[model samples]
Target chain A: MKELLEKIFENIYSNGLSEERYCDIKEFISEKLISEYNDYVMNREIVAKNKVNTLDIVLPNAKVGDYYSQLLKIEDEEIIEYWIEGLKKTGLEVVSEIVLDFQKEDNTMVQGSANLEVFDNDNIECQKQVIGTKNKGLVIKGNPIMSGDFDLTLKYKYKGWFDGCNILERKLRFAINPDPRSLWKDIPTDKNIKFYKDDFVSEYVTVLANDKGLQKDIVAASKRGRSHAHEGKARDDDFKLYHNDENGWYIIAVADGAGSAKYSRKGSEIACETSVEYCKQALQMPTELEETILELSKAEEGYSNRSISTLIYNIIGGAAHKAHRAILDVVKANEDQVRDYATTLLLAICKKFDFGWFVASFWVGDGAMCIYDKERQYIKLLGTPDGGEYAGQTRFLTMPEIFTPESIMSRLKYSIEEDFSALILMTDGVSDPFFETDANLNKVEKWNELWENINKEVDLTDDNSESKNQLLNWLDFWSAGNHDDRTIAILY
Target chain B: MRRLPVYLLIDTSGSMRGEPIESVKVGIESMISTLRQDPYALETVNISIITYDRDVKIIFPLTPLDELQLPDIVTPDSGPTHTGAALEKLCSQVEKEVKLSTPEQKGDWMPLLFIMTDGHPSDIMIYNQVIKKVKQHNFASIIACAAGMKAKVEPLKQLTNEVYSLDTMDSSSFKKFFKWVSDLIEVGNKSIGATDELLLPTPPEEMNRII
Candidate 1:
């Protein structure tokens, strides 16, 4: 088109009909051509702008307290390269420097504390960038300080066919997810707060007594759950571990207080203390029950020994009844309702006999008691969890119905093994996360996983000097939606 | 991971066409922001929105709190409030979405339900019929909010004992109500395993606990 216009001008100049007329013809054709050229370039710019708008620019979502980075891309290449290539095909060029800026609409970025940085330098820019060879596209990197929807506007500038620059704006949206762990705040329970109980009652207790044949080493750690700690609420779980050196018996009692109960912390404390103390006294040496247990241990595997069942009942079942009566005594003394002191009780008593080991448990609520033998790949659940029709519902020792002879006998579980790995008892806080269901408590693989996890945190080897703190740390493991006061006792 | 499923039943009838509906949208946005700040709710809470008008629709399916994108909630020029249909949808969603504990997997926490309306149910017969089904789901808590003067509390009582009233539908009033709702959610998340009825947090001044 330029050549044709040049040729016409030359023709007019050579003919020289009249100097003024020649000049007038040249001016008219030149003006018309310039307008047409401008119109064509404007049309091309519109098409290119439309294509730029259609570019798929997706930014990956970020997480709170996590460093995030994603390369700015249009198609596959860097934004600048993709834009320049797309414009070149449309007979246009980016003649001027390309600049990128994020136009903020609100305080979203301020709350997020994020920054856009050059990919290569990793230097934070104030949401603005000058695009060049060294800086192809943006690298949004930061440890997002908060979680929320962040709206961003990216303003791009580049010189077009005209001398002026063309500006394009793109809106981007992304959300920062809150870190589940960061949200949990561990506020120590206030001892002087309302309904306050003894802090040491539910805090933690560990024992290592090597007097028995198997060298019993036990660790019982109870920690306030994330939920309880979040609100400065007292721990509602308790445990008591005792080793009768003279009698050669190891007894463990764990209890979970009903969260809805007001004085459940005290209830759990009394339950654990009373149950273990009762068993400690009942399992004394030179007692009739000991001789019966010894004889039962020597009996055949299939022998249905009625005397042993009755004796085990009088020992373990009697402990559950004693715990219940203790809770009732507290209720009576304090002029409180039994429901206010609702708690679940799980008691395990084990003694090494000449024949093997006799392990018996009395469970009166939701929790778990198991005899786990990792080498033998064997797991025996002491009793079925007393889960109600709904998820959080479980019978409590404070409830009178659970003290019936039939109910107590039904809740009693005992086993005789030549050798075993560990006798473990836990509250629902631990069982709900580790075993999950009653059936899983019987699965050897699940027990193995639990054992491996425990070993990872608390070494169950020769020396358990650091096992207390390690076991307490292990109780802090995060399980989504399972935050409750955790209590676990392992006799290995 | 056990999710704490939360269902929001909103009324989008003709009466909520203008400022009321806009206030509701703002209220919901504020609620999401508040819940995001809570660590327990952020980890376990999953939200679903069910809107009822001349027609009932599930505007948003059950989505994790962090991944939720607030959808545009619009009301018709005029329409009937079919809360019964919304309840029916909720029942189906609960059955299809809320997991039950099994040996293989830990089930989701009992779901929570919140219903907001500015008028009585247009389909009363269906409402009565489905109320029993809704109760059968054994939600962790079912709270009903009667918004504005036109809302009848008696109808809400049939659905849940936890009925609240908002005197106005202004942005501030809705904001306060929703803020209280977030507190309720936080409390629910903290007390997930409690067998007793969920104890509600004290409501803001703009809202009143009717029951």
Candidate 2:
């Protein structure tokens, strides 16, 4: 030890006694002295009888916002009282005093004087003292306010140790788990930022053609997604709901623009407006379609009528084709490529006939259109979502291949129901969360759940005046990892 | 919940024994911290790590961003870089972990793969054979990076079209590269329904994208 000290002193002197050298010397001297003192205390016969090397204090883990209490167990019997320090910030407190019973070496149980003293009492919330005198243990109890792994350096002052070595320091490591719901952050979007489009769109159009027995309440809403809002981008979804009171027909169109395309917002707007306008003009003189539908509805359940399909195709499918051509026309007028105007379109034209409610729809992409019946527990999906091999790949209206006759024919769906609870059309933003898979859209239970969730926020029983605002508020439902522009049109 | 699976393939051969391996660890830690702050990434991202030396070891399995714990990575004193074996193990893990969309269930998003190495593969023949198998998985994006001056670009070029190179294996360079990676992940999460190919974010000045 003397040789090592001399070598250290020589090195420090050669280093001119700088701050680093002084710290090194001080650390070396303290370590040497502590080891020498420990060795001397260990060799004595009297000290050997009271030598306590290890103190095992087991601490239980905790979680935020939970009332945590655990009995701390220390193995040594000679420790009469433990004065624990350095727990100022932690939300924990120890009971003042308790009597402990420990077995002696002779196997005889004896009462021992034991107590736990905590210095800081600034954040104590527990009032009960340590209970059970005979078999008492040190209890640390409080409600933790934060979540993290805490390494506590506990200074324990106990009896029955070597001279000048009564103070023992131990490290207690425990973790506090965070509340799962607290991790999600809802940062509101800046409305007046750059690249802001006119996103204030909420329509409540009531179609009341009493002579024709067509009484429908229509509400449509479109909102920017959290992802686009986070980046201060514009809402890329658009919807147009037109009720032709003259012919008792409801033309509802919803479109979702591609997120990566710069001009997709314009594409979606044109798609919805052009499709609803075209369908409105085509169905203005629908005497031929009305007769074809009446004949088709009178046929057998499994009958496939060519004239009805042709009429529905001319109305619904032609609307989609016109919307595609309109988007291409706009792209050409603006000197842009077709990809810049990529968008998905879902067009539905429904009318209440003498036979039943006839609904015809044209779907081109990943969104969903369904006729949901709550009383009968039935759901009919208009068309299958065009999900690609990957998650995000979907066919767009701007694509030339989607304009093919076979493609358009396959997308056309017509259904004649006696009545439906609701006719809902949604973009991928709403469909991806409510009905995750294409098959889920057909599941009656999924539609029930969606209706239940919507009814919780919006009163669907009566035609309430606040249904439009309630529907807009319901659009803000939180779905993790699903943040995209949302557009939905409901005819109930 | 639809997870966005991400696989990180790291080279831990003998040449990465000192500061290079330590810097890599720091780079990954930085990346994890950055990703945790993004709400979209925190909700959807799941990460897996594979290390290759004389043997390939999966240090971390597919774990969510919220629950991920990066383990300690060690390198041998001297060993060959079996990049082929690492790719083979990755193929099996992807098959077991990545879910494909079916009629009944919604699957995870197309996975993203990132490979970093400092030298040529010792098992070249196996690497060539496994390249086609890796492509069959149809990953959303596959980025291969040759780190440090001694790294060979030719070997990494055969693996992916999106190849990059780092001039040095320092902490700052790795940090910049990982920051860019986090940005790429954020962009990928939002723009999944693009009809065209996904656009990649620009790299930092410390890293160069090899065309």
Candidate 2 docking classification: acceptable
Query: Per-model C-alpha lDDT, please?
Result: 0.78, 0.80
Q: Poorest 10 consecutive residues of model 1 chain A by lDDT?
A: A84-93
| C-alpha positional error of residue A91 in candidate 2 after TM-score superposition, expressed in Å | 7.8
- Looking at model 2, residue A342 earns an lDDT score of 87
Report residue B79 deviation for candidate 2 (angstroms): 0.8
Candidate 1, residues B1-211, lDDT tens digits: the string is 7788899999999999899989999999889989988877887889999999989889989998877877678889997899999999999998998877776656777889999999999999999999999999989999999999999999899989899999999999999988988998887776655346788898888888885
The DockQ for candidate 1, computed on C-alphas, is: 0.43
Q: Where does candidate 1 stray beyond 4 Å?
A: A1-61, A67-146, A154-173, A194-214, A388-390, A462-466, B192-195
- Spell out the clash pairs found in candidate 1: none
Model 2, TM vs. native = 0.79
lDDT for each residue of candidate 2 in A189-246, tens digit (9 for 90 to 100) = 4556533466547788876547655477788889888777666678889999998877
lDDT of 1: 0.78
TM-score of chain A of each: 0.70, 0.70
Displacement of residue A327 (Cα, Å) in model 1 is 1.5
lDDT of 1 by residue, A46-138 (tens): 765666577776666567767766556443221232222221111212222222325432324444344553233335365224233323444
